[model samples]
Target chain A: MRRVLGVVGLLLLWEGLAAWGLLNPLYAPPPHQVLLTLYGLFQSGEILPHLQATFTAALLGLFWGVLLGGSLGLLAAFSPLFADMLEPIMLLLNAIPRVILAPLFVIWLGIGLASKVALSLVLVSVLLFFAVYGGVRNVDPRLVERVETLGGGRLWLLKEVYLPSLAAWVLSSLKVAVGFAFTGAVVGEFVAASRGLGYLLSFAQSTYNAKLSLALITLIVLFVLLLFFLFDRLERHLLRWRPRGRAESQA
Target chain B: MLRVENLTLGYGGVPVLEGVSLGVGEGEFVSLVGPSGSGKSTLLRAVAGLVRPRAGAIHRAFPPEALGFLFQEDALLPWRTARENAALGLRIRGWPKAKALEEAEAWLLRLGLQGLGDRYPHELSGGQRKRVALAQVLALRPRLLLMDEPFSSLDAILRTGVTRDLLRLVEGEGIAVLLVTHDLEEALALSDRVYLLSQGPRARIAKEYAVPFSRPRDPVGVRSDPRFGPLLRRLWQDLEEVALCAAS
Candidate 1:
């Protein structure tokens, strides 16, 4: 209740600042204008297709990130030889800025959603890969020994110890990478797209509609926040065994 | 029966123990004792296959399923409930979840961990977690057990009770135990025979003593025994010499 009230108060303060002309209405439009624009977009249903395009790309990217990154990370952890073999190559790939590849992705994938999804995959895979890789590598050696001594083979040890230990790490990195995934989608759209939030932002920028641009920025921020909230809830629900440290604040 | 002949273990160019040979007859209880850095834990680890010995021949009558190890730390899976943690070994051995959990529950009950099977590791007390850890290995019903200072972290009251409980179980089951400890009293109380490890890049057995106490032993009785005090003093003297040699 208090958190909701605090947010409301901040929104009212922004409204008051805009009404008094303390803030420039051209660049920082009032909250009501943004809210009205959102409502207009909703009624017209013009945002749906673009929203769908962006979300579809993000979902595909997340799927690949979780699947391939997780497997490769666990594999690397199990074999130091594999780690040595692939680390240099992975580092070389990671060193190349993913955003810089948008033009190349556009050239290769065309101006379609494929390029955007590909760009998002590049972002999410690196983050997710490191998270799972570190998680797998950090399992307690003593615990591994305990399992091995009980007649468990390598397969058993990996299933019981490595995978479960990596769960928390995977979830945490996924939350962080979701934002990057969205950014990747937007950047890809900015490079070349007929749809999505990035295209809308670009369109507004080109037309010099500062209010619309600000409104679109606000919508993207809201989308990111919603994604974070959803993940936070998912983490709590799936990992109930994990202790909640700041219960008072969370509550 | 198990035999570790001329076992040499170390990392890279450094050797922790060398020319170390030991044998455990069927159902025998042996304890390895030494001062800090004496490689007692290293020896147990070598037997458990956690440490690859640089050179040695370790012959075991049974396969991996017949050997269990209790680490110094509980090492319980943080994400798993107590029952799941206890059952992990069985699950790894290819048992179904239901059967594995049933076996884990039985061991948990045997270890007086009834009604706490669903609790996660962080929800358990230190003593309770240790008990769960013990049950995890015991659930496998291994013929040979390698324990690396399993009760070193407990308070005296808890330690005494746990030690007594563990001894009773091992004796009843007729399992072989190779325990490592720095506590002379613990080594004296539980072991059928005790070997003192000397420290070095090539540490060797400095002294071997056959503990004369009978099974179902108590600390009070062992402390009162006339033989106990002199044995302690002798082991202490031997350990001091080993430490001096190691320092040199």
Candidate 2:
């Protein structure tokens, strides 16, 4: 209830400023106008194809990113030689600004979904790779010893200890990865694309339709927020073993 | 069932235990008591095959997997429920999930942790978690148990209760045990024999005492027995001498 009121309060302040012309109308469209533009865009069904394209690209990128990064991280953790040889190279690659690759990806894959996905994959994978690598590396040695003494082999150790420990890290990184995936897709589309929310954004900018651009931006924010909320709930469900603050204090 | 002949163990090229010999016969309970940093834990680790001896051998009648070790800390996996933690050993041994869980549930009940199989370690009290640890080890049906101050973190009252419960269960199962602890009373209450290790720079067993108390004895009652005070005093004198010798 308080959160809802806070959002409402912010929107009212924005509306009051726009109504009184305290804000420049040409640069900052009113909240109501942006909402109406958003409604109209949806009603005209002009946004669906772009939305679908962006969603498919982001989802595919996220899928491949998590799979490849998580597997490689696990492999690196188990093989010291591999880690020693490859970890530095991975770090070097990750150090470079990945967004700079958007144009290169577009040049190679053309101005299509493939370029968007390839860009998003690079962005999301680096974040996930480091998260998983660190997670696997930091599992408690005592736990590993305990498993070993119980007649567990390397496969058993991986299944019982390493995987569960890595799961937590991966899940936590998923929130960041979701945003990165979306950002990668949008930015790739913004740089050069035929259709996407980012293309619409660029179109609105070229046409000087501030309300349309703001409306598209609002939709994108809402979409990302919704995904983040779902991921938060998933995290809570998976990590039910964690004691809540209230329970800890009471104990 | 286990013998450590002149065990010399260390870590990082620094000697911790020097020429320490010990034995735990079939169904025997032995405790190693020592001052802090005296390598009692190192000795236990050596016997458990976690630490390699520099120039000694440990012989066991049972195989490696037939020995269970409980760390000083609870060491329960925070992510796993009580049942899962207890069942870990069985699962590692390739038992199916249903059978492992069934046996783990039985052991939990036997350890007086009824209805706690679903609770995580954080939700359990200190004593309850200790019992869960015990269940985890005992579920393996180990021929020998190596424990390093398993109840040292508990309050005095809780410690006594856990010690009593452990004594009863281990005695009933006839499993040999080698325990490391700082508390002389805990040693006397639980073990058939107690060995005291001197402080390091090359710590070694300074003395050994056989407890005269009979089996199935209550930990609280054994502490108050007529013989208890005299035994404690004698062990304290021996420890004091070892401390003095180390100081000199």
Candidate 3:
């Protein structure tokens, strides 16, 4: 309740500032203008195709990113040889802002859904890989030994210990992964694309349409927040065993 | 039956135990008591096959799968309920989930964790969690149990309560136990024999006492026995000397 009010208060403050011309209306339009444009875009259904395009790309990338990153993390944790081979590569990838690959992906995969999905996948995969990788490595040795002494083989260790431990790390990372997926999709679309929220954003920027740009940005924020809320519910359900306040707040 | 012959254990390059030989006969309860950092746990872990013996042989009449180890740290999986954590071993051994959980729930009930099978490890109190861990190890039906101060974390009252159940179940099952502890009364009260280890860097079995307590001993009742005091004092004095020797 308090958080909602804080957001509302900030928007009203922005409205007052921009309407008073203390803030440049050309760059930072009044909150009402952006909100009205968002409503109009939806009412006219002009944003629907772009929304669908970005969402499809983002969701597909999220799915494959989680799968591939989690598997790679497992491989690295279980085998030193793989860790030796993969660590440097991941470090290099992570060293730079992953969004720079948007242009490269566009050139290779073409200015289509493939390029956008590829960018999102790479972003999410790197972030999730480290989360799961570190999670497996950091599990208590006593727990591992207890499982072993209890006659749990490698398979049981994976099921009983590794996967459950990974779930918390993965879920927490899934939140950030959500944000990264959108960034990747939008950035890829902004660089080059026939359709997407990012392309609309580029159009708004090219036409010097601050209101339209603000509406698209607002739309993106609203959709990402919606996804974050859904993932939060899923995480709460799955990680119900976690001690209260520690897991979610830390993330 | 188990025999650890001249066992030597170390972490990294530092020797924790040296030439520590110990044995536990079938159904006999043995305790290894020593000062803190005296390598009692090192020996226990070595016997449990977790640590490689630097120079020794551990011969076990039972198979590796028949060994149960209870650690000082709560080894229960945090995400799992009491019954699920207890059932882990059973599930690992090819028991179906339903059958495993049924057996685990039965064990939990026996350990006085009645109807709390669905509670997570964090939900349970420290003593309750210990009982669940005990149930987890015991549910495996291990013929030989290696416990590293499993009840040392509990208060005396909670310790006695859990020890009482542990004693009853271990004796009833005819399972052999090798308990590692620093608590003199706990050592003297619970086991048929107590082995004291010297101070560390290169620790070894310094003394072994035959605790003359008879079969099916009550952990609390044994403390009140006439001989419990004298032996405890004697061991305390010996431990003081060991601590002094290490200090020097």
Q: Say which docking band candidate 3 falls in.
A: high
Lowest lDDT 10-residue stretch of candidate 1 chain A: A242-251
| DockQ per model, Cα | 0.59, 0.70, 0.83
lDDT of 2 at A47: 97
Residue-level lDDT for A101 in candidate 3:
91
Residues B39-104, model 1: lDDT tens digits:
888888778877788897899998767888887788887778999999988887779999999999
Number of the top TM-score candidate: 2
Model 1, position A60: C-alpha lDDT score: 84
Q: Which is better, 1 or 3, measured by DockQ?
A: 3
lDDT of 3 by residue, A115-149 (tens): 99999999999998899889998887877887887
TM-score of each: 0.90, 0.96, 0.93
Report the Cα lDDT for residue A95, model 2: 95
Higher-scoring candidate on DockQ, 1 or 2 = 2
How much lDDT does candidate 2 score? 0.88
Best by lDDT: 3
CA-based DockQ, model 2: 0.70
Per-residue lDDT value at B160 in model 1: 85
